[model samples]
Target chain A: MSDPIEFYYDLSSPYGYIGAHLIEDVAARHEREVLWKPFMLGAVFKEEGTQPLVFYPKKGAYARHDMARTARLHGLPLNFPEKFPQLTVNAARIILWAGHQDQAERKRLSLAFYHGIFGEGHDISDKAVIRNICETHGIDWAEAEAAMADPAIKDQLKEETQAALDRGVFGAPYFIVGDEPFWGVDHLPQLEKWLESGGW
Target chain B: MSDPIEFYYDLSSPYGYIGAHLIEDVAARHEREVLWKPFMLGAVFKEEGTQPLVFYPKKGAYARHDMARTARLHGLPLNFPEKFPQLTVNAARIILWAGHQDQAERKRLSLAFYHGIFGEGHDISDKAVIRNICETHGIDWAEAEAAMADPAIKDQLKEETQAALDRGVFGAPYFIVGDEPFWGVDHLPQLEKWLESGGW
Candidate 1:
């Protein structure tokens, strides 16, 4: 393998959840590794003068419906919280903390957080929710909690967001396979073809 | 067969060029007819407080590159005009007039308009360009020019746009199969699956 497919997403992004659910499976088929990098989609939006796709006018309604339909099609459990488009900074900090431990551990905790928030309608942003989920999985609750306050970890997220924006990632579920960049879950098929053909 | 797939597009949209090229081919596979409906995507943008997707900062750069990539993927010629995102009301009026003829003629004319503006980089907004293209195909040059000034044709364009917006279309190359609406060239796969499974 040349390098892991870099996958960037935001926890608040519904499309990010779909991309997360599918990217790993697609990568597995090609015997390729995928690096799930959680970034601040909100930060990107601020710079892009855009809002979430689900917050647009007529398209907004369709986006919500599409998310539900996509979740069903993928056979993934998606119970959207009543308070959606939730703040995901805390979730990112935790994922960054996990990334410091081991790649597998990071992947494990990241997906769990995604499932808990988007899959089960749990707000992983809450410290209690994070602690409970982390404790159940034998993650160091204190370490994870303190990780968010660490300047280095905070800088990690800032750097990641800046890096993603530099790469033309204005939206979530952005993927960079080598020099080629693909954005949104919609680009997955093209990404697959690129992988299969070794760049089309 | 059920109703023909309502294929909505805007003449000035690059993605619309891709949709015009492929929708017919895709629909033919399932023995389905396509209603090529051209609407003013500009009007939709005004209502949504958004500009063309290419005008946005980071996403703009990606869109221009993607349009070229998408054209290549479809094996279609795409020569972007010097004055891009051209004012397409004249072209739309001509299309609306062609729509009054047989569906085949309408498809031919619409694709021609798409090819002229997008493929050949001709300014179809100019009457000379529209007249030259339509006259070669046995359409009366004077009649087509007069058609643009026709209140009914103008009304037809407006009605089509309003109808599309009413159906929750927010972008170019939007599709409505039965009651289901799919947006973007990216949703073509999902649209195909929906047609195959008769709605998943």
Candidate 2:
């Protein structure tokens, strides 16, 4: 069997939310599991010597329009959280922690986080929001909260971010299929085609 | 008649080359004309405070791969020029000059320039290469050379670039259908849908 599609994303990325919404179905069609790996996009940006899409005024405004338009195109709900590009360290930590326990639950927790941020404009960076999402997902809030404070989990995110950089993941919604890297949610069509044809 | 689909691009942009190749057909399917406008992407980059895709180490490598992969996906030939992101001022000037004469010829000359740069890896920044392309396209080489040197034409390119900035064009392969702006060749699907549905 082919390896699972390694999906790398950040909690603060709108495209990442859209990707999380769509990747599973795409994976299912090709009979592949998705490994949801969340890392700090801020770390990637700092290393790449770039800023978030909102840093550039023109690109930022276009990105906001594009984000909503893209979400509409994909039939997904998107509402910008009051604090955009919020600190996602803890959110990422919880996801990594969830993955340590169960991969499926990790995907679930990640999607719930995405829906909260983009679908409902909830600040997932808040621990209360995180705690509430944990409750909704049947994940133990106490363990999840503890994991967020765990040094090992914190280090794990840093390691995963470094690993992502080593693998040339410089953007959110980045996917690795058998060592082939595809970036951006827009490339999902090409990603699917690659899976269907194996390589073209 | 419906307004022409305003296509803003740069000769140095690979995605712009691909968009130039595919946009005419997409326009024809929906019965629209194309207005090919070449501007200085370097100017846009400066104002936006962003570097070209190749400036970042990791994204640069991924872009090289993605450009080739995207070209293949579109079934278009792509060979990187000896000097990529080359000074495209003169190339843009010649295109703008051609537009002053005939829009069709302008598009033809623009495609010829794009094919010369990306298809055959020619250094388009060279005036000799420019002269050769002009001659092959049945354009008067002497007149084309004069246009490239004309201060008015040089200023026209600047004005066009500034106008692009005013219109929120921060990247190549940017399209404006009516007042709606779409960036990137990948967004052509959405652009077409917009043209088909007016707005969605």
Candidate 3:
């Protein structure tokens, strides 16, 4: 079997919410596995010396419009939580935990986190909201919360972020196939094409 | 006739080079007119409190890769100069001058500037290079130079830059179709769909 596509994203990213839904289906068509990896986009930002999209001057306004418009064009739901671009360190810990469970559970938890922030506009950072997601999805809330605090997992996420930096990932919804990297949700079509063909 | 699709670009932008070619063709297919407008991206950058794509650490590297990848995928040639993200003020001046002429002439100059920078990797900020392009294209060099330096023309470019800010244009290859704005060359697909369907 071919190597699984490395799919990296921050759960708080609106584009990542969309890509979380996209990469799996694209992979499925080509009979490929996706290794879903969640990391802190903020950490990536700090390394890259950049700010969040909505914090910029002109790009900020355009990002808000593009976010909704792109969502509408794709027929995706977006409520855009009031605490947008919320500090997603806590949410990412749970997603990393879920990734260890299994592929199906990983996708479920990832999508639930996305939907919480973008689809339903819920504060995903809140432990209660995360707990609700865990309860509804049949995950062990106690273990999940406990795992979040595990120094090992916290260190793992930090290490994962460093690995992402090493691999040149600076944005959410970043995909890696072999040494090639694709960033943003917009490149999914190109990604699918790359998969369909050996490469152009 | 419907309003011309306001095509905004910075001549220094590789994506803008691609967009310069793409927007016109897309507009022609939709039977729409394209208003080729050149503005100072530096001015926009100042207002946006941002830097160019190639200056953002990891994003800088990713951007260099993506720029080439995207160009190749779309079958556009890129002869990126050692000096990219060039001071495009001179090239933009020529473009604005051409825009004041017939549409064909505007496109000719725009593509010439794009080809000179991204296609040929010539240092377009230099007067000699601009002179070469003008000579090859039968443009009046002395007058074009005069236009570039004209205080009124310089003010006009400034006004256009401010106008773009007013319209919420934040980046190169920004498109305004009706009241809706689309930023980035990747959003071209959505822009074409919008033209085809009237709206989403």
For residues A104-191, could you state the per-residue lDDT of candidate 1 as single tens digits?
A: 7767887888888888898866888888888878878889888988899999999989988887788889998887889888899998
lDDT by residue for model 1 (B1-200), tens: 87688999888998998988888877988888998788899999998878997789889888888888889888889898888778899888887896685678778888888888889999877878888889777788788889999999999999989998899988888988988888889999898888888886
TM-score of each: 0.97, 0.98, 0.97
Least accurate stretch of 10 residues (summed lDDT) in model 3 chain B?
B93-102
**Clash-forming residue pairs, model 2:** none
* Candidate chain B TM-scores, in order: 0.96, 0.96, 0.96
Docking class of 1: medium
Clashing pairs in 3: none
What is residue B13's positional error in candidate 1, in angstroms? 0.8
Task: Determine which window of 10 residues in candidate 3 chain A has minimal summed lDDT.
Answer: A97-106
2 or 3, greater by lDDT = 2
lDDT of 3 at A29: 93
Instruction: Give the Cα lDDT of each candidate.
Output: 0.86, 0.90, 0.85
Runs in model 1 with CA error above 4 Å?
A: none
Candidate 1 lDDT at B14 equals: 88
User: Model 3, stretches more than 4 Å misplaced?
Assistant: none
